[model samples]
Every structure is written in structure tokens, then in C-alpha cells.
Target: MTETIHPTTESANRYLRDNFAPVREELTATDLTVTGRLPDHLDGRYLRIGPNPLDDPGDQHHWFLGEGMVHGVRIRDGHAEWYRNRWVRSAAVADSLGEPHRGTPGERDFAANTNVLEHHGRTLALVEAGAPPYELTHDLDTVGPCDFGGTLPSIPGRPGYAAHPHRDPGTGELHALSYNWTAGNRVAYSVLGNDGRIRRSVDVEVHGSPMMHDFALTERHVVILDLPVTFDIATATEDVPRLVRPLVRGLLNRVIGRNPLPEPVIARIARGGDAVSLPYRWNPDYPARIGIMPRDGDSASVRWFEIAPCYVFHTLNAYDDGDTVVVDVIRHPTMFATVLNGPNEGPAVLTRFTLDLRTGQARETGIDQRSQEFPRHDERLTGRRHRYGWAVGFEDGAPGDTLLRHDLDTGSTESRRLGAGLEASEFCFVPNPDGTAEDDGVLMGYVHDRAEGRSQLRVLDAATLDDVATVHLPGRVPAGFHGNWAPEGADLADV
Candidate 1:
């Protein structure tokens, strides 16, 4: 039996309510229920990570500031073994739960909340900005912060790595353009070798600390998106939500009733939050450009190409075509333009870009003008040319009941609209062992039922975008960021 469950925390913030709210405790359920035939060839685990704050931060809470919780489902021998959800225990989480802290001491109290993936032999929960990644055991317990066996060197307390790293399918190496807020104008172009340690790290000069969430990769070059959204001090100090602004202003006015505080003082006191959790916002003054750097060369060989104003949180895939670089991305018209509490600037659009290496010019083309984000393609096609892409759709900034597949070669789209009150998260493609084509595999991710108030693991045929099977989770997994299929091989614990 299932029932609709709602967050009991009192807050006017939509991010702290309904399906976006955090679950209170960790849970483990065994021998899960299945609605269809479980694919025996699919022998692996599916994991996802996102912000799930333990306590509400009230009106000042930002959606990206919460602690992380990882949700995983294990499959083996055609049986759904179990489902588990565990918080990526930073020091703050450990101290709150009364459990002793594990792992190397962190430079700051932070959340490893954006993504979870296995690199080499270690499973890591990763976040951006300055915080280091927290290692996790096979069962998802915190193993402590990892520094690539102390090879991912950082400056003083700053660990300059990104949450999104592009792995070369052919070489088994990982590539990233990472930045830290304190790093000022230079971002590192880092490459992790097959052994999972930083083999090459070069500091590439840029205008300022841009939010380098994700980038593009081709065979010979790494594409850097030095876009308009950037770090801003005023966004942290004064940007509050319009809905709750009156409540804050009224309270400040009542506090200084006898003395009558000045207008500037009242405004500052009303908008200020407890701390500077995330300081990034849309910056129009910053020029939007793309930097093309050789994978085999250094920062001295980097070439920059300017583009129109926009911001991107993710990219589908990129490849080299003759002397041009082709990349597909979900582009937002603007971000954090009117509100600071959450993303008020999208229903993002899917677009394709062609960059001429010789002329240093860029051409942007619209693929799908609908409201969609969280784009994914088969990992086998990463950093290379591909035919298809998949993403979860959003309607007017809310989870739309649609899943999409696009044929880049033909410019045709296929969509699978879900039943009422059912919302889907980012679906990742798992390749078939004997498959011949790109779409010859299964797509897997979470699906939440609003009426039942419980979420489930859903599998779909990638080619037709049809339902294949479902593994009901033990509880509701809040909407999250990114994850991948950790195909079963040698046990990860032994790796």
C-alpha cells in the first residue's frame, strides 16, 4: 500500500515542500517489488545524488545549498536485490546525526551533493566550488574525502575540481575544466589518468570565476564554456525572493518601530540570509565566449571564440568535424535574473553549436524550443559524434510528464508522455551487451508517483522510448542531478 507523504517542515519556499523536500531518515529495503520482467543482462547498480537538506533554512533557503543524499538500487541475476538511500555524510551531517566523522578532515563544512560516480576503483560523491569529493563504500557509507591518492593537488585549502568530468570512452581517462571561487581569474584544465590520479593540471587564464558546471570534449580538443553567469557579491547579500520579501520587510520595520531605521538599513536587514552558501548569479557585464584548448597542448595554445549571452548547466556531447567543433547543449535564455532562491530563468531550450577552429566563430542553431533540461546520450558516444540524445522535460519550470529522444542526424524528436501525476527524473542509457547500434540498450532513472507518494526505478527501451520494466523503490527519492550505471564486474569494494 502507498500513501501521499508531505514534508512537515514549515516553510513558504516551494523547494522545501512537496517532492523537492528532504526525507528524514536513511532507509534500506530488500527483495523489491517489480512490475515487469527484470532484464537478466542488466547486472549492475543505478545511483543518483542531489540536495536533500536535513533541516529547513526557512525563507532564506536556496535550492542548491542543501546536503546530499544518494539513492541506489542493486540488480543481479535478474532479481532486484535492494534499494538504499544514504546521506553523503560531511562533517556537519555526521555531527548532526551523532556519528563520528569519517575521512580526511575537510577545509570547510560543505555538501557533496551534485553527482555520484565510480572512478578507477573508488566510488565518489562530488560537488563543485572549493569542496573536495567524499569517498563512499560499496554499501554507500562515507569513506572520507579523496584527493586521488593525494595526486589531485590543490592550492592551500582550495580543491579546484568540477562536479562534471568527461571521460574518454577510448582511453579510460577523465578530462575536466575545474574552478574555485577564490582562484580568481584562472581555471585548471585537469586530466585524470587511468589510475585515477591527476596526470596533467594546467591553470588556464579566464576573466573571472565562472560557474563551469560542465564542458565539451572532442578527440583533440577540450571545449570550455566561459559564459555570462558568474560569481556576484550582491547576489548573496541582497537577492531574496519576491514572494517572501514583504514578510521580511514587515518584520524589519516592526523591529525598529520606536527609532525608525533608515531605508537602506531596513532593506539590507530584510534581504540578508544567515550565510553565503552559493554566490553565483547571472552577470550581463561578463562577456560570453568559448575557449578551445588542445587536449595535447597547454594554456598557451588556447583560442577563444565569442558568442551571444546565455548560460548552460549541461551539454549533450561534442565532436570534431573537419576544422569545426560540433556540440549539443541545453541553453537558458538567462539565469537567476529575477530571483535568488531558485532557478527562475528557465524552461531551458535544446540547441546545437558549430565552432569554426580557423575563423574563431560560432554558429548557434535551435533543435528543440520546448522547455527541457538534463540532456544525456549513450556514454559510448562521449567526446565523439552521435545520433541520439535524451532529456527530462519541464513545463513552465515544473516537472513535465514527458521524456524525449532526439535524432540529431534527421532533426526528428520522439516523446513519451507519462500518466497523470507521475514525474520522471534524468534517465541514463545502459548499453546492451550484444547491441550493435547506439540506441540498442535500456534507459534507466527514477519516476515519482504523486498519488502514491513513492518513487520507482524505471527502465525504457532507448530506441522506441517505451516502458520495459519498473523496480519500485522503498521510498520517495527526491528529484536529483546526475548518475550513471556502474556495470557489475569485479566487486567495487575489492577494487
Candidate 2:
């Protein structure tokens, strides 16, 4: 029997009410129907992980905080074999499983609900704040917390890892800017070798506990988006005393027959007058600044550049041109600035920042006027100049039924519409083993059709933005954050 979960009045917020609501069923299905020819050489699993809360959150709910559930599909020898979904068993999840937590404790607890990628011959489920990575098999089963085969370095009070670590394709080294929510004013920059051992760790100074979701890598530097979004525990609790506010509201609404307070008032309370918590808030005192540290140097050698206040959740790509650094990113006006459950600002569009090191100035420009999110590109050319970029296109703040492709060389774009009521998730670029061009491979992603109430896996030609194939799924796949293509040999054997 498949269990279905629904949104409750306990939290009358946006994230828990519509497409963002969590699904309750766990399923494993086989031999799904295919709409087009599956490539013969494709042999791997395409997996994605995102937040799915198991317990009641009520009004304190934020999209970034929740238990993680991973959905995957397997393809082999030109056939769609199986699809599976599982919750990452953190200590909290393990308790519900009648087992104990499996890893060393960090300053923050584990959720593993963000991104899944293969590193050092092992697959890892990762989150941003404080948990160590949860290792998994190629088949998507948990293998406990991985300290990189017992070689990843650890600090006394900081134990968090960045979800979007950049792996240098040239040197086979992984680079990450790890930060802890509790450790204010300090962050760590660490590098791991191809052998899965820590190579170097350096502490960088900052103003407050900023939520640095993702950074950018260039040929010579690691660009940091040290913007205004910060962590404030005290303010987060001012509006809604986790225990008292809900009870008071419940009594007034259920027992006294009151209609409850306005959402703006509720939002103000949830923010404690100011948006606070590990979630994130825009800081007015701290000016938005961009810093660049030499990949082979320390924080003391870092150069800082200033920009207008804004929030950036993800960076598409960055490269050095002569004495200036060019970065492409998904730019938002402000994050958590209003009372809405999610971002209340207008749509995020693609923009480029040119940081002139010689003059210490930064200039912003538009790359594409279309509103979009989840920008991605060919990883083989990461930190280097590439010809193409891709993102899930959006109509408003909601997902649009199309995927966009940008040609850097000619400043042209192409859109591949997924029919009328279908929406695509963040997709991965899988390169052809024998292809030479960067855009020669296919783009793979999950698509949900609202009219049919089902989801499917789609494959599109990267060069032309045309549908190549699709595999219909037996169950619903909720929208998610990030994922990667795990090839056949990315396992312990490769290590």
C-alpha cells in the first residue's frame, strides 16, 4: 500500500500547500514505458535529492530545512530498468528506523537533503550547514557518514561541508568553502585530492554568519559571494516562540473561534521582527562584497570587490579574462525580505559581473532577460570559458514548462518546451564518450505533468534544445534542488 501525505492547517504557509508539499509514498518500480529510443551506451543512474519533512513543522517551516529523500532511475543497455526512492537515514531518520545515528556529531545536525554527486570514487549525499556527508552506494543506499575514507579533515567546532563543491577537472581535486552556522565570523576553505584525502584547509574572515550556498571557481581564484544574507538565531525566534506562539494561535483559532492573525503578522513573528534562524536573512549592516582568493594561496592574499546589495543562491560559471574576472550567476533582488513563505521578490534572471582587479571595480550586466533558475553547464569546462549554459526556465516565480539553452559565443538562446502543463527539474549534462564538442552530449532531467498527475524522465539534445527521449514514471517526483550523473565505475572499486 502506498501512503499519501497532505498539507495540514498546522502550517498555513506557501511551501507546504502546493507543488512544494512533501510526498509520503516510497516506491520501487521496474521496466517503465519509454516514449523514444534509449541510447545504447548510456549505463548509469540519474539521482536527485531534496528536502521532505517527516515531522510537523507548522509555521516555522522553511524550504531548506527538512529530512532528505532521494529519487533515482536506472538505465542500462538501451532500456529503463528501475526507479527507486529512499529517505537519507540521518540520526533522526535512524531513530524512526529503530537504529542509532551512524556518524560523529557535528556542531549542527545532519539532513543530507541538497545535492548528490560522485567524488573520489564514492557517491555522497550532502547539505550545507553542519553535517558531514552521508556516503551512499551506486545503487542509492546509505553507507553511513564518509570522512573521505577516514581522511577528510575536521575542525574543533566546525564540521559542515558545502553542497556544491567544485571538482577541478584538470587536477582532479575537489574544492569547497565550508562554513558552520554556530561559528560566527569565520569560514574554512578546504581542498581534497583525487585520492580522497584532505590537501589543505584555510580559515577566511567574514563579518557575520552568512549563508553562502554556492561559490564560483575560476582558473586562478575561488570567488566567494559574501553577500548580506546571514544567520541570526535570536531574531528567528522572536516572532514565533516555537512552543508558545503555535499554542496561542491554536487556542485563539480552534477554541475561541478567532480567524487567526494576518499572514504579515505571522510572518513578522516567524522572523522575530527580523528574519533570523539558520535559514537566512538579508543583512543591512554588512555591505555586499565579493572576494577572490588564489587557489594556491590563503585568505590573507584575498582581494575584495564591492557590489550593490543582492542575493545569489547559485553561480553558473566564472573565468579570468586578462586582469578581470567574469562571473555568470542567477541574481535575485533580495531574499527573505518580505512576509511570503518563500522569496517575495520578482523572478531571478541571468546576469554577469565583471570584477576588474586592476582598478578594484565591479560592473554588472544582463546576459539573458528571461526569468530562470537552476543554471548549469558542462562540468568538463568548469572554471574555464565554455560555449553553452542551461537553466530551467520560469514564467513567474513558479516553474515554466520549458528548458533554456544559452550560446555564449553568439548571445543566442533556444527553448525546449515540455508541452503545456509539464515542468522540468534541474537537469544534468551527460557527455558522449566519443563526442568532441562541449555541447555534443544530452541533457537529462525529471519532468512533472500536472494535467496527467505523473512524472517522467526526459532527455534533450544539448545542442538543439529538442526532445530526444522520455521514460514515464509510475509515481510522482516532487521538485528538487540538485543532482548528478553517476557513471558505472564511480564506486569503491575505482578508489
Candidate 3:
């Protein structure tokens, strides 16, 4: 169960302060206003979920650690039907909102606030921490946690799922590399069939409790990014006692590198790197690695490739060409290198790393020069080579007013700018009805206008980078992590 320690003070973290303040109230209104014409085929809900803590987030208030709330807008037949917002209804959040909690709190509460997607006919709220997903109805209400209709394997200890699971367009199979922080040096790879039943589960070995936020799933292999940023229990200030600092450090040292314990307990006390210092820290001794394990094989089939020490939170796409595997991602120089105040690092640029299986060498190159994050591609082209990538551009770590469309086939990019003082989130491409070309689709997502304090749903033509329409909303929806377009009465397609 989640700890019920009520923080008495407001958070000092940058993410919870200023313009990024959390919205406490939830509302539902019918017949939302539309500023421009919406597409006729755009008949579905546009849902985005992010952290919005209800109460004051005390000392350890990282932006990522706040409670999850989802904002949604429903559009049908070129008309705005309604807009609504609701918290995921976790145990703590339910108690705060005076609603009924739907499921028993596992080792960790279900934040369910990271990303929202429809898979196997179920809409799910997802987070990276070891918590089962909270299901949502088409109207955006919490339907409670799910376990693949009771077909998922019991994780034995702390059960969890990846917030960003990959689906293969060819087979409709969803694959996830689920990791549990409590289970140090261990991770699980699970495959769910098109029927939303667990098909396979394999336990994989790792060095420490590294944060594997995202991975690459190709047709032949699963790319594992085991980086240096590890989970240090000492950072959970509420859990660790003052007298246990030395004991924690000794145990951590042994777990990471198999180092011998120091004979004298109080030989030295360092400023950082000690277990009692930060909730999470960087491990310089750990070599950043990329493992390519066969899609159908076990952990023993993995082939390891070493890369420079860095951190990555997302990957756009990956494909295999002959003996080499090419993966594109947003690369950060370092994360939590010194302190985990927030993402104080420089802008994450779009970079590609190619791993050659025959030679066992990896080379990194720049895909696009612009600083961007939340990269996405046509779902039809996932796990294979195709053109077109879309991402939100960044300025000073905040999403800028432009959406970038990259044409990998032609080695060129086109950008569509939202109005000034407006920022756009990740956009999903909905293919034109019966369209054959990959770029023949409309990109739709949420765009917030800070000056007016309102947000709207924008649909853009994928091939021309032109604005097709904007369905306006009543209030500003906070910028979220990831989202997808769920077209009504249609299967998952590239449009």
C-alpha cells in the first residue's frame, strides 16, 4: 500500500511551481466551442494524462511523482461534443476527492497519469512505477486496475507494467519491458497477444535498478537501454532512517559492483554518492549498454553493445536492416548527474544510434539538429523502416510553439507553427480514410494558448504540414507526457 504521510508544506520543486502549477478542479461540459473546422472523420476522443497533485506535495515533490489526472475532449462528425477532466482515482487520490477507491493499493499506488492508449479494446492509464494500470471507459472514467482479464502472470512481488508498451503493426502484439525498482537487478519482458492475454514472460538480468523508461521493439529484436541513472533507496527520505545511511551505502556498493565492505565503518563520509543522500543518483562505474535480444528468445539470447554514458526517456522508432539495427531517440547528455531537482540538463536532441551485429560496434549520429522530445511516428510504420516522424520542438526545456515533421526518406523536415505564446504536445497521425501513402494522414493533438489561457485540439495535414482545423476548449489543459488518437468504430491504423 502507498504511504499516507501528508506533507505539511508546499513543494519547492520547479515543476510544481509557477506556470506548471497543478489544476485541482475537474469539470465536464457539453458542446465545447470550436474555433475552426474539424475534420469529418475526426470522430473520437482526444485524451491526455499527466501529474496534477491534489494537495501540497511536500519535500520530495518531483514533477513525475505527483498524482495523475487525465484531461479529455470528445469530437464527433466535425463537432465538439464535450470536454472533461478526472483524476485516476488512486487510493490516496480517491480519499482526497471523496470518491470510492477501485482497487487495493499494491506496493505502489497506481498513478495512471503518464500516457493513455487503447489496446486490445481497452483504454488504460499508465505509469512506469511498479503499479498495475487503471482502466478507463470511452467517456474517460476510471474503470479500475486490470490484469489482462486475469491472464497476466503474477509478478510474485511488486507487479508493474511499462508506461510505454510497443505494439507491432504486423501482428498486433504488444511487448513491454517491465521493471520493478524494489526487485533490484531484475526486469521482466512480457508479451500480450491481440486478445490482450499474456503470451510470454521472461526474467532478465541487469546491473542495478536502472530506470528503463522506454525501449525499442523491432520485428526481430527488443532493444534494452540499461543506462547509468539507477534507483537509490536513500533518496526516499521518508523511508530511510538517519542512522541507516552507512548500512544503506554498504549494501548499495555490494549490489552495484560487488565491492568489498570497508573494514572501518566511519572511515569517510562523502557529500554525494552515499545512499542517504539522494533518492536517485548516477553511477559512473556502470557502463551504459544497449542489449539486443531476439523477440522470441529468452534473456540468454541478448547481445550487448556499449554506448557512452547518457540518459534517454523515449525512443521514436527502431528497425533492422540486414545485420545492423538502427534506433532513433531523444538523447540527453546526463540526467540526475548531480541532484534530481528536475530535468536541468540541456535540450534533448534527436539522435540515432546504429548497432552492427556482425562487428559488435555502435555509432551515434544526429538525425535532426533541432532540440525536441516526445518523438512519434506512424503506427503503421512501427518496427519497420518508413518516412515521417513528428515531435514537439523545445525552447529552454519547455515545448515551443511549433510541431516538427521529419521526412527521413528525403532527409528534410517541415514545421508547422502554432500561434505565438502557444505550445503543442505530442500529436498522433490519423490516416485519411482508405489512404494508401504513409504520410497521407492528419496529425491531431492538444495545443495550449498561454495568453488566452485556453487550449484546443489541432488537426494538421501530414503531407503538407498545414493546419486542417482547431477544436477549441474552455480551459487550459496542462502539457502532458504522451497521448494517442482513438478513432471511433475503427481499428488501430496509420491515418
Candidate 4:
């Protein structure tokens, strides 16, 4: 007989009361002060060098401008600081690698590899590489030089090295996946030995384009997702007299800003190229999501699955039990809607699926509130067993925005609603070490208040979903993508 678990009256009542508290308390306050800006000298500059003029721009070096450097923030004590990367030169000797270097430091490029950091115990591992190949130290504070070994491979059209590394729990191997952006977007996988040496490289084909966005790995698989291409349409238009050029330019900018690519160009590219050719239109088979399952030693197989029709941004959480793989899918609307209409209308969904590793089948398990979007899933406390855990997502509903939590086993959910002018992102859970069975885990996330213009890190008891503490920041965190928590004394915090 199949077992069934229903939501208890007490549990329902508690959820009803606290469902909105996560967004209502002082943690949602937007009042913030601006701290000092990041040092301008630390910015990394890049040059376009390829066959296509607009696509490559040749030898002319272009600065990405460090003014918009602020993206995410982490805090300890009352003090808060912005997260930025330092550029370091590649050197064979340790002593030769210290501090102040020229030509945009290697560390800056390495920092661009990951949207956020993930921590395994105290050891923090991040995927780093840019125009040049290099791995940035995930250490919290102290700056160390970036390492690219020798003569890193380049991705054409795009000035960067394509290397993203993640740890495989089953084999305990650090695998780095490299792509040649300049040469038809080919991918190569290299294993990082325990001694920090890179093994042989094998070239694999996925597609040819810098449109790739994010990827993940499981005990038996690796997943890759590609983004749509961007086409500038304003350049192709009827010629106008000198006096009318300014007016035409103004109108062109407005239309291009809204639709980005013209209808004709979009059609031409879609027809000329194969599946991976055009950057727009979601393909059912060439999923925005790609998953690879490891089989025996070094060999692994790949699987591609589509979540939605639009651009699906994802965060992956894997379970050791081998029966499940949970992916958080965030749907990004077409450029036309975003640029013209703004962020008010687009909807988002949080989808969880159970993958039968042996059978090669993926089954959708549960979904959170549909009107809500931008789901951030974290399972830092799952450990060896995957039976019990918590997942979180945000819902932008009519009443207000809310945070929703899902219970894996019971398939029941709870949501906390926030009042007007508030938003939240990036949810992480900190587990207790003693192994005592009190509650499941501890919940932590960043709450942003647009009205007051600020963000706060809020912690709560995972079981009750009650606020335990709120760490206020000195300034706005400018909205970030993903984050991971390292237990106290983990190597990740030392830097």
C-alpha cells in the first residue's frame, strides 16, 4: 500500500501565521547607506580579436569599466564588504606571484567564471577562467595570484578561456570543463588530480557559440545550458538626410532597446543554422538544461532536457541516493518584454524532478506556486541521505511577494508572503554538526527592500521557518545570483 502524509492542523496554522513573516520583519527594511566604491585601478580590460569586426573588433582593447563591479555581498559581524576579484599574474614560482601586476591581472578573469561560490566543508571551490585560463582561489579575504599553467586555450569571438570546474562526490575528482569559444564552441573536460595537476584534455562537441550560460554535474552526469544570441537591428534601416539622422537615431535606439533583434534577422538566422545556430526560441530537444551521469571510471553519458520555452536560468542540487536530482528553473522572458514593458509581468516557476539514474528516465515530482518566479534551491544539509530536505522559491503574487518552502518527502509546501515593495533571492540552509535530530536544518537568505533601498541576510530555523537572526548590511548588495554557506573554520572562509 502507498503511504500518505497530510498537512497537520498545527503545521498549517503555524505556516499561516509565519508564511509572511520572512518578508514583513525588520529584515525587509530598505534604508541603506552607500559605502566607498571599489578601487578603479583593479579593473580588468579586454580586447576584441577575431574575423568579424563587430563580433571581434580586432586588436583594439576595450575596458569593461569597473564602475558596475558591485553585484553580491557576504557579511560577518557588523562589518560588511562587497565581493570583487583581484587580478594576479600567472607565475611558476610562489614568491613571484604576489601582488600589483600589469595588463589586467589574471585573477580578475578567473573571478568571472562563476556567478557564485559553493563550499564543501571549509574547502571552497570556484570555477574560474576568462579571456585567459586561470583558477582564482576561493579563499575569502587574502588575495593570491591566479594560475593558468602555460599557454591557455582561447575561445574565438569571445575574449576568454572556457573552463568551469566542479567536484564529483562519487569519484572525489575535481573536473574542469573547457570550451573553445572562438572555434565553433567545442568543449573539453580535464580532471584535476589531488596534487593540483591537470590531466589529459579530451575535446567534445556540444554546439558552437558563446551563448552557453550554466552547467552542473552529478555522480553520473554533466549538464550544459546555452543562451540565445543577441542581434542589433537598428543598424539595418533606410538612409536619412543629415538633418533627420538624429531623429532617426533616437527612434532606432528606442525600438532596438525594446526588441533587440529585428524580425527578419531572427528569421534568417533561425533558417540558416541548425538547432544550436540561433540564440532565440526554446528548442524542445536541445534543452536549455543538459545533465550528464557518470558511469564507471572516467567515462560519463549526457542527457538534455527542456524546462520551458523561454530562457531558463538554473541552479542544480544533487542527492547521493541516486534516485533524485532537483533543478531550480527560472524563466527569463523575451528581450522585447523586458526592455519595453519592464519586470512587472513575466512569470516564474520552480520545478523538481526525480531522475532514475539506472533507467535514464526523468520524472517531474513537484512544483511550487506558479504565479511566483525566480526559485533559488539549496540543500547544504542533505549530506549522505537525501530523504529529508528543504527547498525555497519566491512568488511575486497580487497580494505581495512570498517565499515558498517544499518538503521533499511529504510533498507539502508552505509560503511566507511579503508586503509591497520587497523582494528576496538566494536561499541557503546551514546544518547542525552534532547529528542530533532536533529540527531538519537552519534557513538563511537575503531579503531586498526596494522601497528603502537595502538588503539583509536573514537566518531562520529550517523546521519552523521562523526568523532567528538578521544581519543588516551597510549598503545595498545590488542584487546577486547564487551563494553557498561554509561552516565555521572551513578553508573557504580563511581567504
**Candidate topping lDDT:** 1
C-alpha lDDT score of every prediction, in listed order: 0.80, 0.76, 0.76, 0.38
Candidate 1 regions exceeding 4 Å error are: 2-4, 8-10, 154-159, 235-273, 490-495
Best first by lDDT, ranked? 1, 2, 3, 4
Model 2, range 74-147, lDDT digits (tens) per residue?
A: 99888889998887878777787786776654434466999998777777898886568888776677777777
Model 2 scores a C-alpha lDDT of: 0.76
The Cα error of candidate 1 at residue 293, in Å, is 0.5
lDDT of 2 at 10: 42
- RMSD to the hidden true structure, all candidates: 7.3, 7.9, 6.3, 14.6
Q: Residues 281-386, candidate 4, lDDT per residue (tens digit)?
A: 2323333334553422332345544333345444334443545555434445432233221123355555555555566665654455454443433332211233
Could you give the candidate ranking by TM-score, starting with the highest?
1, 3, 2, 4
TM-score of candidate 1 relative to the true fold: 0.90
* Clash number for candidate 4: 26
Give the TM-scores of the predictions, in the order they appear.
0.90, 0.87, 0.90, 0.56
Tell me which of candidates 1 and 4 scores higher on TM-score. Answer: 1
The TM-score, computed over Cα atoms with residue i paired to residue i, of candidate 4 is: 0.56
lDDT (Cα, tens digit) per residue for candidate 3, span 102-187 = 86554356567788888877888988746788888888888777778776533433326788888888777778888765555777
